[model samples]
Target: MIAWMMLAQAALLGLLGAGVTVAGIAKVRMNDWILGAAAIATLTLVVQIVASIIAPFTGSGPTGDPFEYWVYLVMAVLIPPAVALWALIDKGRWGVVALGVALMSVGVMVYRMHQIWFVQVF
Candidate 1:
């Protein structure tokens, strides 16, 4: 995994999480911003999937357990859509907050995956 790309993804997730959380706090419902953020986040993770696929060809591989990294990747990729669906179904303020929390959680997970890829070599 590329360190810079991981950092960029983390930054994006952090910003999106904060934005969604603030919107939720302001009593926002399931709107374009929230949905759009979710969509963007999901698409970025899909990009990560592609990057992971190409990493081996580029001579970059996780330093840590590949299984663990993959599990984190898969889980992080799943969160946005799941939360977005929940928000859409509930259409409630707390649902928005939940989506925000999920985004933040995925951010943290991505950071951890970065650590796994770059820091935990053994």
Candidate 2:
């Protein structure tokens, strides 16, 4: 629930999302950099999950109510892996497009995490 950490994650996700989009638009094939970006986003989500688990004990409160936290957790944990798996099933630009979508989702999740941790309402 650290404000700075959430902001940093959001910014990183935004940049990664933009990168993915540009790479896909340029007709770039699957590459290590794209995979690395996905990996980094996955790691960031994992860190967020861990932070959420420990937040209450550390006095970060309930993360703006229970329902919101659960929603965020579910999406954050599930989306990236699902997208990556689906993308890997094919070897084309659409795969990169899927990754772009996944990256965008991560950016949204980052913002949602920030809201759930700091905002007063859903």
Candidate 3:
């Protein structure tokens, strides 16, 4: 995985989490803005998947186990949509908070994946 792209993905997710958290604190229900942000985050993960596929060919392959990195990537890709679905179903302020929390979790996951790809030893 490319360092810049990984950092961008984490930053995007962090911002998305903060925005959703603020909306939740204001007691706003799930709305287009939240859903749209989630969609955008999900799409970025898709882009990350594509980047991962191409990165090794360009000589930026993982320093750690490829299987582990891929598992993290696949799981990270699922989070935003899952949280979006949760928000849709719940239609409550807490659901928005949950979405925010999930986004933050995915951000952490992305960082972990970055470590697995480029920073890990042994």
- Each model's lDDT: 0.91, 0.78, 0.89
Runs with alpha carbons beyond 4 Å of true place in candidate 3: 120-122
For residues 15-111, could you state the per-residue lDDT of candidate 2 as single tens digits?
8878887888888867878888888888988887777778778876763666877788778777777777776777677787778877887787878
- Say which prediction, candidate 1 or candidate 2, comes out ahead on lDDT: 1
Question: Which 10 consecutive residues of model 1 have the lowest summed lDDT?
Answer: 113-122
Candidate order by TM-score, highest to lowest? 1, 3, 2
Using lDDT as the measure, the top candidate is 1
Clashing pairs in 1: none
- Which regions of candidate 2 fall more than 4 Å away from where they truly are? none
Sliding window of 10 residues with minimal summed lDDT for model 2: 113-122
Query: What is the number of backbone collisions in each predicted candidate, taken in the order shown?
Result: 0, 0, 0
- Error (Å) of candidate 1 at residue 75 is 0.6
Per-residue lDDT tens digits for candidate 3, residues 1-122, read 77888888899899899899899989999999999889988998999999999989998788888999899989989888988898999999999999998888888999889888885543
Q: Pick the candidate with the highest TM-score.
A: 1
What is the Å distance of residue 48 in model 1 from its true position?
0.5
Candidates by lDDT, descending order: 1, 3, 2
Per-residue lDDT of 1-122 in model 1, one digit per residue for the tens? 77899989998998999899999989999899899999999998999989998997889987788899999999999999999999999998999999998998899998888888886453
